[model samples]
Target: MEDDVRDDALDLLAEVLVWRLAGDRWRAVERALDGLAAAGGDTDAFREVLHDLELAGPARAVRIEDVAVLPVPEPVRERINQLVHTLEGPGRAEDDPE
Candidate 1:
């Protein structure tokens, strides 16, 4: 039951990410993230799910300016990249040792 709930939450977050990215709305993304967090989901976990969605190729990537009208910081981008790597799992990356 816990696993099911977690998956459902993550799936919702992924959908929200795709929606926000499609509409080029960073504020919407942030609001969705906050709502998820308030509902007992981890914000960082949702961010990771967003990265995974991007990696899975269903979500379109947008320029920082397209989303926020300003440059997104590199650290945040790196965090997203790291989330993708983490969610993609071991042995999924060609360079992964496992």
Candidate 2:
């Protein structure tokens, strides 16, 4: 039940980010989405991001003059940050064997 709520919230956030984001932020969002996918984030949203990337063709780094400034609510902002942190996970050494 709790996990469902989390997934739902992340899905909603992903939906919002997908439609509202533009410019350089799109690249960051794409990376974050990729990390989220690796971190076991929502499948539906992840699939959508993958589809979007496919439609967008090869990923290229670019910067344009116009950039959208998304005004996220505090709670939503915090939640998104938390999700990214979860995606980041523990700070472990690359060569460290568990």
Candidate 3:
């Protein structure tokens, strides 16, 4: 049950980030998602990120500038950051040995 809630929140956060991230941040974010997938860390979250990345490009193809400037509410950004930290897991840096 706890895992489900985490996964769901991670999914929503990933989706929001894919669309809301400013400038070229999405590239690094995509790379992070790829790295997470390669490391087999949270398959569900990886899939969610991929799904949102797929939609994000075309969804903002025309109004890219407008969407780039669209403000993400402060609360949502904070929650997303919290979910990202949870996804990273405690005492588990990217270089840490499993």
Candidate 4:
């Protein structure tokens, strides 16, 4: 049961990270994370998961791109594409948004 809860927490964190990188909006991610944390999940761990997602490159980049095409800001789309390219090794991390 505890392991199931932990997995659910991690899944929520992954979803929130993907949504943020896909340009869903900060408030949306914050609200969702807050809800997950309220459900006994560690907020800090969720944040770490988000950080790891950003660093994972290939897998996470593809996930970002798959969601990034749906009515996002142009700048966000550009950033996602840049991250994908960086993951693909055609661009440098310096080109990424901080």
Candidate 5:
């Protein structure tokens, strides 16, 4: 991908990734869930897994091209595509999970 396109993708991803996600705000949400388990909510068993975002330090700009890096294998390429779609559903992620 071209530099411009990659930059655009990165911008969009950043916007989406950080949406409604800040440590202070999420801490309150977790606090609100304090009684979830006691109330017998099934999700209480995995409340942490329900989080869509994680608190982090300073952001770093990362371009899609830097991630894709043309020489990647076909499996990695397919995995990338799958991962993108998964993110669309507010889905699971791992650091370069296969």
Candidate 6:
């Protein structure tokens, strides 16, 4: 895959991950998935990333340092607070018996 496409795929993957980690950020999820569909092209890079994401199991911890390394866009940052809340708040998987 080309560098630009790879970057876009990675970006979309990160967004999906953040949504998953954050728990049900549906709007962001929809937007990111839409972006992925638009840029995905013939490359399996996004699919591979998504597959890995699925196999990874529930998120353990989403550290600030980890998120800082990503090239996440500005508009997405607008929802970071909610994401962080889901990570740290009562909605976390650890709080559930199942």
The lDDT leader among the candidates is 3
Tens digit of per-residue lDDT, candidate 4, span 1-98: 14554455445433433443333344344444344334333646644544544342223344534565333335544444543343334345456665
Report how far residue 69 has shifted in candidate 2, in Å: 9.6
Query: Candidate 3's residue-wise lDDT over 2-81, tens digit each?
Result: 46644664665566654655545445444544544453455666566555544444243445454554444464455457
**Better model by TM-score, 1 or 5?**
1
Query: For every model in order, what is the number of clashing pairs?
Result: 0, 0, 0, 0, 0, 0
In order, what lDDT does every prediction score? 0.42, 0.46, 0.51, 0.42, 0.35, 0.43
The model with the greatest TM-score is: 3
Count of clashes in candidate 6: 0
Each prediction's RMSD to truth: 9.7, 12.0, 11.0, 12.6, 15.1, 14.7
**Residue 23 displacement (Å), model 3:** 18
lDDT of 2 by residue, 1-98 (tens): 14554455456555543343444454555465454445354566655554454343223543454444444335445445565455334442232332
TM-score of each: 0.31, 0.32, 0.34, 0.30, 0.23, 0.25
TM-score between candidate 4 and the true structure: 0.30
The pairs that clash in candidate 3 are none
lDDT at residue 87 of model 3 (Cα atoms): 66
Q: List residue ranges in candidate 2 displaced over 4 A.
A: 1-5, 41-64, 67-98
lDDT: worst 10-residue window of model 4: 52-61
lDDT of 1 at 67: 56
lDDT by residue for model 5 (25-82), tens: 4343344233322332244332332232222212355444434322323433343354
Shift of residue 84 alpha carbon in model 3, Å: 1.6
Better of 1 and 4 by TM-score: 1
Report the CA-based lDDT of candidate 2 relative to the real structure. Answer: 0.46
